[model samples]
Target: MRKNIQILQDIVSRKGSSKVLTFSIPHVFKALQLLDKEGFVSRATFAKEIHLGEGAVKTLILHLKKAGIAESTKSGTFLTEKGKKLTNQIKNTITKECKVKKSSIIQGKYNHAILLKKYSKMIKTGIEQRDYAILYGSSGCTTMIYKNEKLVFPGNERECFPRDAKTKKYIIENLCPHEEDVIIISSSDDPFVAEISAKNAALWTIAIG
Candidate 1:
């Protein structure tokens, strides 16, 4: 299974330009066929759903198109006759493949083996040396961070405020201290970070991982 994943990763990373010199297990091939049946997935969505990198998905799409098994329109992707037929013929195989892939991803995330290794390295570098870490982003963003490592502040309590201007200002003013420095972790560069910092008279620092 690991070998198959490595092959798929290579194929996607190489934009399917690499020649298939190795045999992919029947299960892996079936899973690819099933994904092809689902027509156009956005780069981000595909990465999030399949646990593959965006660059790899882009390459895989290109390769699938070249193989005449998939057709990608602007909005989404549709399976070609070949792709649909292949998926239908190998329905059982595809189901097994999907289960295997899903299990692998779930295990990876639930165990936090890979993610925690990365976070532990970051923390060791003094990146987490702060009085408090203000994770200002969507709920999904905060959840992902919490999954990677245990939160030190709030004593195991996770709080999320609505993304409203007035409420945001109030939270920053109350939670942040003027004299002490706090670290700000944002998924993106947005004005909300600046607004929160300005309101609290605190400096916003980015957390690099």
Candidate 2:
């Protein structure tokens, strides 16, 4: 797993003379997810789905190709065997993600949550995840760890959203999180921003943890 994280680090990190990247690690993983689901995707399709411009999407494809993770053919763009394996590995770490309605915990119009597998030990204050989400264009982020079948904020033993039972029940029933799992919810007015914000924070946690 550490080796896989290092591989992603290289994709996001700048070498001595590489062009400045407009995209980040989350974009890379999202692109991989798209390819894994669709099998083959076009630059236009990739741009539309990943929320990147054509030029930036092209550059991302080049990076993936250089890493031997994907290739472009007459049919469009498709992941290589290495890319598929990497995507599966990433899916293992980030178990599930979904859009959730605004609730007492996250009060934005649009919210998304990402489940990071067994990352409770790496979460100290959760401020890091929140800061990352804010930097990605969100008001704030809520981080919770699943323990004793309930979601609780870091350093707090009590259950989160105790005052909002409906939201709490929905989260618990939908996410189906296990013990030691970490849930990160980011909120924004824009739906895409909300999704990206949550995913970005999750990626940061994986990168640093």
Candidate 3:
């Protein structure tokens, strides 16, 4: 899976003199996720769903095709067998998620918390996930790990937001994370942005693994 993630990370970069990619590593996964859910995707739909312009979408589709991940036709773009395997891998890794209500601990009007399975060791200060979410245009990301029946920040055993039991209980009940699982909460004014932000940060965690 790490090798495959490295492959995905590589695809986001320019190959020699080729055009610079307008998408990020997480956008590649999100695109695959869209195809896996919808089965097929048109350029316009892809642009709208992935929040990219038509030219960027066009190039993105081209890259997917070149990578043997997807194919396009009159119906639209559909994942290839290889793409299906990769998409399923990603879906199974994420496990579960939930919508979070605005609270003092949350930064924006909307929020989403995604559960990353057994990747707590990949966290280092939880700063990388925040950087990833911010780079993806979200307000911020809060990364916490489930350990010893408590939610805590990485690199130590300190409980995260221990004073905010209400929010902590909400997250614990909804996500149901097991030991070593990571919980990433992303916040933004736009609900969709919040969702993608958490997902992008989750992808970063997975790739880092």
Candidate 4:
């Protein structure tokens, strides 16, 4: 079967909590951000965390309240009982997906993991030009394999993989790549594809950064 077609199908068919995890909410990020900051943060801070306008933040908070996941008061916005449980559930799922198996680490010159953002499409083209790429991942993961080549990504479920220049630098330093190495970037939100692709490798070192 064609590897690309199969991978596309798998991405479309992923279901249940996996789907929930795939289509993350903008407001959820804000709520989680507040949760991370001891369960309360000012509106301006919330807006800054999610990179949204002040009016947009207010609207999102209202949405969160309607969804029974958050509330707002003089103290600040906070998660409700349901919200905490949901957040925990999401966290647990991501943790399970991202768990790196020791067996997947391959020994070679070097294997690079990149958080593909500006260069994702370019890398995909490079792999295709080189010929034959086997692919994997659920809705949130993207894994491609070719002769002596492998790529693990956070799929295309989101509009774009979250990133910045600082994040990119961090990836390079951590992955410790060499010249001509294949840099595969994955989202922390969905690492299942990358993890599975690495573990399933027959050759080549697949490193996740």
Against the true structure, whose TM-score is highest?
Answer: 2
Q: How does model 3 score by TM-score? A: 0.87
Residue-level lDDT tens digits of model 1 in 1-209: 23333443343343434554222222224335446655555656655544456565665566667666567778765667866665454332112110001121122111100011112223322233222222322111111122222222222333223233453343234333221122222222333332221111111111233
Alpha carbon RMSD to native, model 3 = 2.2
Give per-residue CA lDDT, model 2, range 1-209, as digits (tens): 66776777677666674678888877887888899999999999999988888888888888788888899998889999999999899899897888889877789899999999999999998899999999889887999999988889998666897788888788878788999999999999998889888988998788788
User: Which of the predicted structures, 1 or 2, would earn the higher lDDT when compared with the native?
Assistant: 2
Stretches of candidate 2 exceeding 4 Å from the true structure: 14-18
Work out how many backbone clashes candidate 2 has.
0
Per-residue accuracy of model 4 over 1-209 as CA lDDT, tens digit each: 12322222232232342322221232343246456557887788866655567766666665567667677889888888866766664333222122321112222122223222222333433333112112433112223321122223323322121333343334445544333343432222334333333322211121111
What is the C-alpha local distance difference test score of candidate 4? 0.39
How do the predictions measure up, each by TM-score?
A: 0.33, 0.94, 0.87, 0.39
Per residue, candidate 3 scores C-alpha lDDT tens digits across 105-167 of 687789999998888888898899998898767897888899999998888768887788899
Strongest candidate by lDDT: 2
Evaluated at residue 85, the lDDT of candidate 1 is: 63
**lDDT of every predicted structure (CA atoms):** 0.33, 0.87, 0.85, 0.39
Worst 10 residues of 3 by lDDT: 9-18
In candidate 1, which residue pairs get closer than 3 Å at backbone N, Cα or C atoms, i.e. clash? Answer: 39-77, 39-78, 40-76, 40-77
